[model samples]
Target: MNEMEIVADRGAWRAGFEERVLAGYRAAGCSEPLARALLERAAKGIDDWTVATDGTEWTAVGVTQENGAAVGRIHDLTAPQGRAWAERWCAGQGAQRVEVRLTGGAGAFADYPVRGQNRMRAAAERPELPPGLTVRRLTEEEYPGWYAGEEAAYIADIVRAGALTPEQAKEKSDHDFALHLPQGYLTPGHAFYAMEADGQVIGTGWVNHGFLPGVTFGFSLEVYEEHRGKGYGRAAMAVGEWATRRGGDEVMMFNVFGGNEVAMGLYDSTGFAVLDEFRFMEL
Candidate 1:
């Protein structure tokens, strides 16, 4: 892992760094499209990234200030030298603590809690509905419900995960505000739906088909606060699984924070198996 360089802010910079990161991600079992998506999604304007090589082979791809600290996605975590380089890189960034994120939860099936993230999956079948429960495409008239529900769900999850205080969540909520929910609000690669029971709205779910076949990535679901604990979350996932299956997918995969026991229970009871468990260490 020697000869590592700051490549950031350098001319012809794109070739070496992005390639190494992309290569490392691919070598780590990520599909090419998924690898590119991960790179495209690294924090915008992050000017600190590091790289290591064995001549032509990319040994590591490191970034600083991701969600606020430095970390590396090494191609070979087993190599002592690569891990050593990661330590040096994070320290160079003045990181009080560094966290190495293993996407897709490589930890659940393996050793230690260090890799504790669950990449869950369930085969698509017409999920059984609770008595009187159903789902439909969210109508334009449901904008108010959608807006309120999404905000509450987003804030609740972050707050519960200790990622934000209530006030902070509120402030970040409007980072992408929609003063009004437009009719037919469709985003490519995403679909939103409303869950119903006895013809009344119970919850909202947002879903997307991600790379790696047969997997519908996640359901950003929120049941009205008063309506939770009555099986809406599970029903929402069932509906989501069905939707993905209808669209020709065989498996529906998703992740919830390790601390989200309620959500974890819903998935586990609904037959999703833990494929990975992720753990983060503040180094």
Candidate 2:
């Protein structure tokens, strides 16, 4: 395949790119507000390092240098030829590995050895909670400890996935909590919950009703260590979907880091479909 030339018409390229990003998310059932936010975050840091064709293809590439190794992130790549060009370009730019975020579907990129992050969604419907399983809102006293533990675990997951360094993860963790839960346990659109089965605490989860307009977002769903393999995760999901529908939302969505096969399998078997993916390939 011939290498794609650098696109000089940045204005037109950006407009088309933004349109595709929005269309992909909307087609995956995201509301207009959520789609726009995704587009804004995706298009924030394009520089001269990007590669594109004048027609319908573009890849905005960002390179990060950490611990003397260069890693590349390629966004919105549209074709097999474009992928080929991006690999060569990134390798030439000293990137040891490249992570590509693709919208719509993987198509030809399916053979890549590694996957990064994914956004998954399912239609919201009230579900019957497993027998003896119940959920209750976390008390103000419980919120602080829950939030701290959850934040640490989340930061660890992203860092392990190579999506961010420790420093970057900490910064993002602080910013996300400040933005999403500014009022702690009383945040109007956010709810934190503890799950109990037969009066024994088994897990905790949280959800946000305002982030995606008409969609309810599950920020976290965790079953404690001793509670695994007993269908508690599924039970927690049932509670979340019930809460989502009770709040009048029609769709439920959440993000999970790649390589978490157990979590991915649970989500998939419970009717969640992947809407977007960041696929990783070692150069």
Q: What is the C-alpha lDDT of each candidate?
A: 0.57, 0.76
The residue pairs in collision within model 2 are none
Candidate 1 lDDT score relative to the true structure = 0.57
Q: Where in model 1 is the C-alpha error above 4 Å? A: 1-61, 66-76, 80-85, 103-118, 163-184, 209-214, 275-279
- For model 2, what is the error of residue 18's alpha carbon versus the real structure, in angstroms, after optimal superposition? 3.9
Who wins the lDDT comparison? Answer: 2
lDDT of 2 by residue, 92-154 (tens): 889988876777667767866344545555554556678889888888899878988899988
Flag regions of model 2 displaced more than 4 Å.
Answer: 11-16, 30-41, 45-51, 54-57, 63-71, 88-97, 111-116, 122-125, 162-175
Compute the lDDT of residue 254 as modeled in candidate 2. Answer: 82
- Candidate 2, residue 137: lDDT: 85
How far is 99's C-alpha from truth in model 2 (Å)? 2.6
